[model samples]
Target: MEYTEGVVKDKETVIHVHPNDYEKAGNSYLMAIVAVIAGMPLPIINLIASGVYYLGNLKASYFVRWHCIQAILAQTIIIPFNSIAWGWTLSVMLNKTEPTLYYGIYLFAVILLNIIEFVAVINTASRVNKGENVRWIIIAPLTDKLCSKKNKSPYPLY
Candidate 1:
């Protein structure tokens, strides 16, 4: 079977993915976005849905696996922030507590962050769909470590 490989040099390793793999990989991110939008009222639902979608794609090709893993990891990082925002909003609603400037600012910031993430996801997916590789400054190391080749140890190394 012939495999397509993306070329990356000079501190970047580009893994090539076929069109099918590219679509599959991009679908993972899209799934996360859908989960977020659909589960907006309940953050836990979003988390579970996104987590399932992300994990389900891990067994794909190197390119797809890396892209999906990165998306999952990025979602994991954002989950806590979302939880905090949701909790604050819920508390304010249940207690009838007046919302403060701080709360407003924080909510605004969270919304901005989410918007940025959504844009990034779309951009990355588009590039990936076009056979272009995308890199995340924050998640790059984790993706590299998780996707790195395992060392061959013939000396019974477990």
Candidate 2:
């Protein structure tokens, strides 16, 4: 095990993790990506992944649990947003309306959001695999709050 400064260690709490287990912990993110892609054209897969992470890993270490909770929380937000976007697109299609400027902007925004999230998760997972703490700006506080409130699990060597 090693102690590494978190992404915002100066201001945020630092987490200690084991090198071998960091990548294991980050598997939650990979699962999230898989769910998102597999459930594409339908927005429910995010919920499935989120549920699996939150319910299936209650006994995971604090380090793994933290990342899992963050991934779940992010999926919670993204799933609904995607559902709404798809619904909007469907409504437009049903009404036979010409794609408007707003639609273009919305499409661009969704694409941008997806790209940003993909990059962030990949970067965070890679960093965490190296036994470094990584934080997501929007979800970090929530992750901390939830993980702190839960029973803290000891870091495992494996």
Tell me the tens digit of each residue's lDDT in model 2 across 1-158.
44453222425544444555577667777777787678778777866886687567776666777778888787777776677778888888899667789887987888788788888877877777776667788898988888743434554332
Summed over model 1, clashes come to 2
lDDT of 2: 0.71
Q: What is the C-alpha lDDT of each candidate?
A: 0.72, 0.71
Once superposed on the true structure, which residue ranges of model 2 sit more than 4 Å away at CA?
Answer: 1-16, 149-158
Residue pairs clashing in model 1 are 5-16, 6-16
Per-residue CA lDDT of model 1 for 1-158, tens digit only, reads: 43435443316543434567778777767877788678777656655765686567545566667777777777878878888999999999998777999999999998898889889988888887776667889996888787634322122111
